[model samples]
Target: MSPLVALVHATPAAIGPARTAFAEAFPEAELWHLLDDRLAADADAAGGLTPPLRKRMLTLIGHAVDNGADAVQLTCSMYGPVAALAGQLWDVPVHGSDETMLRELGWSRPARVGVIGSLDSAVADSARRVAEVVPGAEIVPITAAGAAEAASSGDAERLSAALENAARGHEVGVFVLAQYSLTPQWMRLEAALSTPVLSPPQLAAGELRRNLLEAP
Candidate 1:
């Protein structure tokens, strides 16, 4: 039987891109989506991950594991740290959204890494992780102004433009789109900047497939 991979999403915008990524990267795996649309708004309102919010995220992850998930992936970068806690509580492998991408970046030993995101919180979290993984490398946090609004409004052009505009001057060894919502724009962003662009979904999918499906 194909392994069932549960995707825990904090926003609806991440769903399509994540599905596309999994389909391309781990086509044989079955997908289960667990969405809490208000998760992001609640985190933003509370000025980041609060205690109650953390509990709620854990509950969702637990539910996914209980429902026969072979592994779980959190699609929100803001609540990424919660994955670690969830891993302790569940027997299934639980993964934070950007872990694989950040790990790869660390292996590359880039001199400077640019983290681009629609939300400042997500960018900051990703930048912090980058710092942890690549201590000697410079971390640049770029908040794509208006990109969140554009994404919410379903304005792809505006989203791409905002990201491009924000990323215009920064010349980094590699660029990381910190939010899963920004994954769909990675190709365009990479082409415009002429640099390697990394996003979470595809990398996470591949990692999960390797660990769960290909492991001997």
Candidate 2:
């Protein structure tokens, strides 16, 4: 049997595209999307990444590992810290979605990096990661005006617009589409923002390919 990649999805909106990306990128491996609204909803419910959210995510990670996932890709940008905390519990490596770009998006000029998301915590955390990798870049996090309702029901247009709108003002923008569900909106939002959008799925897919190919 081919090794299966365990996709732990934080938000329902991101689950579909994340699995899609997994399929396209790692066709040799089976992809499993285990969606958890509890973790994401807690962050949303709290208006950001709170301790409660982290605690919830930690529990979810354990559950995924117990179920026999070969590798784990956590599909949340804001829950970076939670993912980090959970790395010790499982035998398989746990990857954070925002880990895609590393510090490559950072710059010394203090460029404004807009981390737009439906959840306040994701936006804030993605910004910090940008700042960490790129020393002087400024991070501006804005929530989509009404994306949660739209995304839950599968409204791609609204999600795309939300990404574009969140990135409206930056001169040297790097938009981190925090969720997998928003991946389909890349092209549409790219036309509107004209800013660099860093997607987690494709980036992770690339890494996964290399790792798989190089595995002895």
Candidate 3:
């Protein structure tokens, strides 16, 4: 059987981009999506990841594992840390949304890294993780104003513009899109700003394939 990769999404906007990423990067893997639309809203309302929210995330992950997922990827940056805990509990591989992206950034050892996200919490969380992996680099957290709304409404132009405006003044060695929902806009943002842009989904998909599908 093809390796089944479960993608747990905190918001609906992430589903399409993730599917596209996996399709391109690891087409042979079977993809399963589990979305909890209210997850992002609750986390935002709580101002961060609360104990209950963490438990809820674990429960969702546990369900995915129980349902025959060979590997699981959390698509929400805010809930990323939960993936670590899930990994300890489950035998299969578990990955946070930005793990591979942050790891690669650390490898590059960029002087300054810009992290762009549609939501403040997601940006902050991603920035925190980036700092953990690349302690020496400066982390710039850029919250693209109105980007969440633009993404939810499927306004690609507005989303791209918001991200570009937020990124314009920042002089960073590399820019990372901190949210899976924002991945689709990375290419256009990179072109407009003339800077290297990194997003999580594609990188995560490739990593999963290398570890699970290609490994002997």
Best by TM-score: 3
The parts of candidate 1 lying over 4 Å away from their true place are: none
Write one digit per residue (lDDT tens) for candidate 2, span 44-104.
6676677766777777777778888777788877677766777777767788886765644
On residues 62-84, what C-alpha lDDT tens digit does candidate 3 reach at each position? 99999899999999989888999
Tens-digit lDDT string for candidate 1 (1-216): 999999999999899889999998999999999999999888877778999999989999999999899999999988888998887888899999988997898788899999998887778878988999898999999999999988877788999999999998998999999888888888999999999999889999999999997899
Backbone clashes in model 3, listed as residue pairs:
none
The 10-residue segment of model 2 with minimum total lDDT is 101-110
TM-score of each: 0.96, 0.85, 0.97
lDDT of 1 at 68: 95
**Pairs of residues clashing in candidate 2:** 14-181, 106-134
Displacement of residue 84 (Cα, Å) in model 1 is 0.8
By TM-score, the better pick of 1 and 3 is: 3
RMSD of each: 1.1, 2.6, 1.0
- Which candidate tops lDDT? 3
Pairs of colliding residues, candidate 1: none
